[model samples]
Target: MMALQATLQHHPLLRATLRSGWRERWSFSGDMLPALRWREGETGGLLPQAEEIDLRREAGLKVYVVQDRSTVDVTFQFHHACCDGAGIDRFTDDLMVHYAGLREFGKSYKFVPTVDPNRLAVRGAYGLSFFRTLKRLPGQLVGLMGAAQFWGRQPIPLLAHQARDRCTKSTKAYPALTSFLLDPSQTLALRKAANHRNVTVHELLVCEFFCALWDWQKLYGQYSERHWTRMMIPINLRDASYRSLPALNYVSSIFLDRRGDQGGDRDQLLKGIRAEMEVIKRFQLRYTFLFVLNILNGMPWALKRSVQQDTCKTSVIFSSAGKTTRRCPLPRRDGFLHVADLVLRDIDGLAPLRPYNCVTMFTLEYANRLKLNLHYDAEFVSEKQSDVLMDLFVAGLNQVADTAGTQL
Candidate 1:
């Protein structure tokens, strides 16, 4: 346990080396704590996938929940400093294990491995973090151009692109789906294809994802100027900075704005991701502290806020290692939505080196069944539009699998 906790503390990716500006460590006292708790978990069984109440933080932070329901609702409090979406996921997974008697809690749940504490690689994402300058304009522009050129080319047709026509309006209502489950077999097959292609799974997946989107566009080029949903990929620090120490939210979301297929061909996109990834992988492991020294230089105050709002604009955010939503589902709550289970597993262990774009499915898990939660904006994507998206998502999944030669 000492080793695990220490490892948790020591890994650079696990630790939030970024200064929180506050002199004092965070305190989770008062109304800031959870407002409700259930003595018996919502699940009739030993473990549930997602707990109710939908308590989470911004940019997918992490929280610890304990049900001394007899006590006040304030028991489940979290320190925003170190916890992240992945971290929360890990906590929930372990909690469920402990709850289910599969894994003991506390003393029973102590295992630690050695880790290196460094953040330079992960820190480099903020290119402006270097040069002590305000605008990362140069790097951003270069990266943007490279990314842009990569995407400018079209590979897939449109009608099959599920992301199109769905986000004309934003959703803040209940989640549209229950859970995002991966067909481990399908994922494995895709990985193998990527390996055979000599490209990364992420590169191939991104390529395939874009191809699928393009295919949809070809069918119905709704607008004269083609614009699709901007995708976000979470870069995990495991391969680059540190090895598998369950760090909560040890990830960063990199935006890939495809204005009519900017990704270069099969060769270029893979190369760019690999090049960028390699730089990060090297910098984050040993000299992340140096990168930290440059942050204030890279991003000034106003710019930082803009970045936060644009990139981290999810209605709910969480991090878990595994077994997210394993806790039994809770009754519905006001002002809250369901869980978004994002599974980005390299089931085939292919292209661990190349970066992959994120594929997230937001859903509601009730009674051990996963349902997609679609929060729709009445104006643009009506219930009808939401339905279209649902159908398209199914279509997209199937098409992608078929394209990758898998039995959907």
Candidate 2:
């Protein structure tokens, strides 16, 4: 396809990977850089065929241009070593601009590479001082301990055991990932609701997630008034120097503490979460986690693995990439390629090296359309239950949206 050709030819990362490979094995040591490998496949010219991309290959990054009924669907799968969501966003932006220029101008334009060696935060001024990080380690440890205890009390023992049994019976590392596209009107209504309630859409969605989870627990007779759940939310850390640069994995996460009883008052819960996020942002607590990660980067492999295992306590990874106003190179007001829909989906079970429980939810807004992607561990979240959970999540969104006319 012309779009595919233009994307592959212009984007530096894609072009370099096409010429090189994408198997940038993750190492704390700076010995191995990222590479890419390409594969060309036909999907029988149908829908949802992009799911056929084999993520198990050692390439670490896979790009597929699937031929659908009307248009070409370009799907990308990359290892975290290549980049975090923010990095990937930048790469896709370049790809789109390249495609647009070719479509509109019929010529290849000069591409600006956003990669920066100085933008590496581990050794940069943007990162916190080691000594200061060490000083705060005790407090951080206390906070983490409290969060762990809170989460431990939440997941129902019987439910977890049953889910584990179901998962053990199945050999799949991941469940059937699902994608939902919200129309422009729906996205706008949700935004209006979020603004009216004085909460970021991120917090609003997070609250809805917990509400869904709580509903499931109660419906399944597993909910306890004394229990609470913690969801880990990734926070972007692109500061002044690196904000413009195309970098990889510049991210940290904070666990949101949701008490079981707080699910009743959605507005109140949103306010509390917004306030907590504000405090976290104002105090730069996310950099503390980055500092800890930088420390792990220098440790022995065994020690780093041990630390990661010990710290992996969250119930789910919730990522809302916010919104992007960037459009294609061609003249289009609100979308890519004028009429095509832009949807972003994560290829689950790619990184076998750092395996973790997968009840992950990702959301993003592009050209006023909001898309939701849910990837769950088949072992932990059963297929039937996954559908039910997604339903509850959507229902919760409507419930919150109903408050659009009400003040916080």
Top model number, TM-score? 2
Candidate 2 lDDT tens digits, 263-330: 88877888888988886765556765555566666786844574544333555678877775353343
Instruction: Name the runs in model 2 displaced over 4 angstroms.
Output: 1-59, 103-108, 114-170, 173-175, 294-312, 325-330, 334-358, 405-408
- How close is every model to the real structure, measured as TM-score? 0.47, 0.72
Window of ten residues with lowest summed lDDT in model 1: 346-355
Estimate, for each residue in 127-224, the C-alpha lDDT of model 1 and write its tens digit.
Answer: 33445333433334444443444345432212222232222322333212212334456655555666765665555445444444444334445322
Candidate 2 positional error at 347, Å: 13
Which regions in candidate 1 have their CA more than 4 angstroms from the true location? 1-25, 28-36, 39-82, 100-172, 178-184, 211-230, 238-247, 261-300, 304-387, 390-405
How high is the CA lDDT of each candidate model?
Answer: 0.36, 0.58
- Candidate 1 whole-model C-alpha lDDT, 0 to 1: 0.36
> Per-residue error at 165 for model 2, in Å?
14
